[model samples]
Target: MERPQQPIEHWLDLERDQLFLWVPVMLGLGVSAWLWLPDPQAWTSIMLALVAVALLALAADRGGRASRAVAIGCAGVAIGLGLIWAKAERVASPALTKPSAVQFEARVERIEMLAPRGIVRLRLVPIRMIDRPGRRSAAALPAQLRVNLPIADLPMGLSRGAVVQMGARLVPPPPPSVPGAYDFARVAWFDGIGATGRGFGPIELIAPGDASGGELRARLSMHVRAQVAGGPGAIAAALATGDQGAIPLDDAEAMRRAGLSHLLSVSGLHITAVVGIVMLVVLRLLSLSPWLALHWRLPLIAAGAGALAAIGYTILTGAEVPTVRSCVAALMVLLAVALGRAAMTLRLVATGAIIVLLCWPEALAGPSFQLSFAAVTAIIALHESPRVKAWFAARDEGWMPWLARQLASLLLTGIVVEAALSPIALYHFHKAGLYGSLANIVAIPLTTFLVMPAEALALLFDLVGLGTPFWWVVEQALRLVLAIAHAIAAAPGAVTALPAMPQGSFALIVLGGLWIALWRSAARLIGVVPLAIGAFWAVSTPPPDLLVTADGRHLALRTIDGEIALLRDRAGDYTRMMLAENGGFDGEPGLLSEHRFARCSRDLCIADRVIAGRQWRIVATRSAYLLPATDLIAACRGADIVVSERRLPLRCQPRWLRLDRPMLAQTGGVAITLATRQVVTVRQPDDRHPWRVPARAAQGSDNLCCSMQGLAKQRQL
Candidate 1:
């Protein structure tokens, strides 16, 4: 007889058993997404193996331990093999040292319907290095090619297997230089993109962008465009088909203000809508059949509807990374319910995350991926918490309870998400949305129900000749919504003050919070600790005074005696914290807008005069900094350097014989740069020193961090 299993062993066994074939398959797909890296062969090989492991696990469900173990082993080996293959392929590809711009015959692989920037992805036909190209090499396969369109023509749609070619400037991918941010090249590579260019150049229609079965999707897009009309037409197009090319920026903001911006993409809502429609159709058809109708067949219909909905949505959305991730998550929900297990939102989210990260490793770094998933995860987690549920549960039956629940959930979600992502958002956009929640409350819903769905309806009218009426109605409604969003966004206190959070601190917050919230057991428990630490850091840490950004990207620091001084070439007068954040940086938690930057710069000029009159000075700009100097003809001198964005200003200036960049940077970091040849130490113990940037910048260093543009240059200032 088999020995009795110990309690611990039983628990372990149960947990291990959760590792089904699909888990590995999903894992592999996620791993495959890393194809965005310079490793397609690896991802492809891994993808194949992951699929194999899934098959093995499923096949061994009724088998003994040995069989399951074997399956797991094979799967693991395949994943490893795939990774190795990717590495080899990367080494095999020639270093893109030669800058060759040419008109080549190529295949259009994919099209990204990004708003404002429509990118057409292409795969270059592999060519041999020799005269008579022998066997085609994977190295020559296009890993990067994109066509940046004006969203208008891009939303027209393309299918899988379309042929196209164009001109572009060939260059190496920008080297990784920023910490805790997404990679740009990998995004291109994953889509088989070799280069990005403007204009169609020429279009010889080899095939319809939609393939054999995508005709219906094409029809839907055309129909919706006709129904919505102008801006709303574009909005509905985005909703119906994941194509938002025509929607004006103002309209998009209105929907955002309505707190319903999520509806624009082909996410849960679109899937749900499609599933509902499909299920209704299928169930009614079954009802007419009479036989299947009596057997509680709705579940089967629901499943079928969900599957169909997923496929339809995928095609409509052009199957971008985010949309694909959402589709996979939705499938998990449907699958869990169908399998008789309670569909846990968090588990679905985790599963989806695993799928996304593994399949497209680059997405792990993208802000859209992070923010969308964050908001979703927070909402679901809050909804599922026993305490929160109970709190809402105890309420009496009335509108007050409903309203209270909505407000509470919103507040919790806003605080948690903003708290979680504020650092990263600032690090990337250089602006945080301080009053985003207030704007979202009024915006998200209005966009969701009023704008999105109504716009989607207009598409149907477009199918027929009479599309004007529906289109007109949507435009009128959209204008009102747009007006409201702008009015509210412009309202006083809609945004608040925030500047760039330090890079190191920002990274810690995102990594720590994500870990705590996602991981289970002891790991998950420790996650909240980071969040607490981050909150304290935020509230107590005062704003920087001497801030500098060069190459118009990287920003660097200084904090002053209760007032902030900014040094940037961007906008200023809009520097009110509220304007930057509420403008979309989540109410401007960190970093101000160019408009604000401009305003502040003007004021600084005045402040510099007052400061100079008192014999107090600070280095404020790359234009040799603000110093009091009287050479009697040759040199200008003041007491000392006040603030310095120039890493070493005086040395380059020949005025001061000896120069210490660190002394100035530290002093400037604290907005105390007031002396030259005088090395002043910053007293803040937590301040990290020398703050080296990744890519070199010849334009001078920024306070917060250097931008990719800043570093991609050949020279450093």
Candidate 2:
């Protein structure tokens, strides 16, 4: 007698299979929300509430559709709350508010040479902080500090695991440069770096550290550098040791523009190559022995070897989040093989994501995690779609059918990955690599077939002291890869700029992507609604009318004709580049040289215009400079807004709005629309969050009269 599988049982099985895929997504969303909470204590209340709901769901009756839904909802909440707790534990630390000169001994964990900038960045573990002269205690300080050392001052033979004592002025990492911009402080917090600063003087080597694993990795990087030379050598070192700082900035930028930057990083592709090569070699060798081949499960044995090799590769590459993610994915495949189950399923991807988030929830906010997972998810979804499979099967078979199939697969995979990642790339970097798919068509095969294999063989040969020839081969492949990147990047309009999407719209886009990728039925088409809405919103967003830097050191105003006019010439390149890229400016009429409407001298610049039939005058000055009272009074009388680096002591009409250092420090930056008289300020919500380091206490009150008189007298110039 045979029993038939009931429809309800089949449906339940399908639901169970799909349910695991959404767990990580929900957890990531909750973690993002948790990061935005104004107070850390608020997570406690949230956790309690979520736990109650989860318990209620858990207590629901089983074997019903509603029960299954409740169970899935409960699982998602539990995962989210668990991640919130994990993140809180990782970021918890004492605040470092004030800046002070402190002497400390530290072990160099990592060192990066910024050749273009002539600086060396060191990641250090603090041994001791001297609170006062001639007195030191091992009292708790920040776990780590990222210090910059000028090339001229860098000590000789500086290497990882070497202990050094040095004096430096340390300050808490600052908040974001602009609203909705990357939060360096939050990132530093999770990375265990409490402060950042420049070393003041010479660094003295206190003692040599035992050659640890990190030291060995550094030695390997140095050896790779020695084997190769110049920029290619640096690229080889990056491939060998995951120290990307070796690559030149310009080349890195080119690679990014060409969408080939992933080649430099040890990610999924590299992991898979390593594992696949090892597994194939090991399996072939095992099969050669008849006794073992007959007794053992060859596939399982090969998978085990692959998993081990993947783990080794991950460790050798510093076990970064991406490496960990790739390793997890590889291991999941191995596990499925060992269990005689489907190996390449979305469930495996979801399982990998859950593991990564559980171990390092902070990665949820990073672009690498998002983009990598998105690419994988989309590829799996598209490749497994019945319609896509049927369509491909229906295509005609021509000459060289196998080669045609392989090439078609590669091209389709590239297209799917690019489509999946474009929104995220535009949202994060504000640039779209238009030729990314074409570049990948050439790059993916070249790297997978030639570059990575050569590097792996070289490393293995180096262990036996016979790697020179292989290293030479690696250098040649690297040169070709770099050439490809440069050629692609040199293409006209290789990268296009897009305006930043609103947070709400970005959320919608993310939801749409998930819906399309995760859903199994025709209902997935509903995702197009949100995707279209997000795209429309992004295209419709207008550029800001006025731009100001956080330090109040530069200002730009939009002319009536929609051209940007710089208020000052010496603004920082970082702020200028970010603004220019986000505003979709192109070549011709450069950001710096175009629209010279504002006139400037050593101390002052002024511009005037009529907006919406209202006359608006703008005045800007440095704090150290002086202006004659007659000029100042007259300017204030006519100006609708006055902005200065420091507060000025001129009585202005009530209609005049003053923006100075104190105000700018709080707002970070501002954009004003002259038509509606609406002011939009860049103030990050996290600036006021409880986890942020408190600002230093205010100094004494200002003497406006004395400052004004001094300015008047200095006007004699």
Please give me the total number of clashing residue pairs in predicted model 2. Answer: 0
lDDT for position 492 in model 1: 62
Q: Which candidate number maximizes TM-score? A: 2
Query: What's the CA error at residue 420 for candidate 2, in Å?
Result: 1.3
lDDT of 2 by residue, 1-717 (tens): 532434544555555557668888877876766765545567667666766776776676455555556556655655675676676565776545657678888999877777667788988898886566566543365888899988888787777888999888777776655444566777787777777888867689888766566677778888888888877788877776777777888788889989988878988888888888888889999999999999999988899899998998788878887888888899888899899999888988898888888888878878889888998899899888997787566456766885787778778888889988888887777777888988888877777777767777887898999988988887887788788889989899998776555677777888888888887866678898998898778767666556666566677676767656666565556666666554544322133234455556667766777777877777777446768877876776676677777766646431446666756655556666677665555553333343353442232113323333333342221
Instruction: Score every model by TM-score.
Output: 0.60, 0.86
In candidate 2, the residue pairs with backbone N, CA or C atoms under 3 Å apart (3 or more residues apart, or in different chains) clash, namely none
| TM-score of candidate 1 on Cα atoms, chains taken together | 0.60
RMSD after Cα superposition, model 2: 6.3
Q: Can you write out model 1's per-residue Cα lDDT over 342-401, one digit (the tens) per residue?
A: 776666776776666556554555666777677776667666667678776755578887
Q: Provide the global lDDT of candidate 2 against the true structure.
A: 0.73
**Stretches of candidate 2 exceeding 4 Å from the true structure:** 1-16, 40-63, 78-82, 130-141, 392-399, 463-469, 556-568, 571-573, 582-594, 608-617, 622-637, 650-657, 671-688, 696-717
* Ten contiguous residues with the weakest lDDT in model 1: 688-697
Cα displacement (angstroms), candidate 1, residue 601, comes to 18
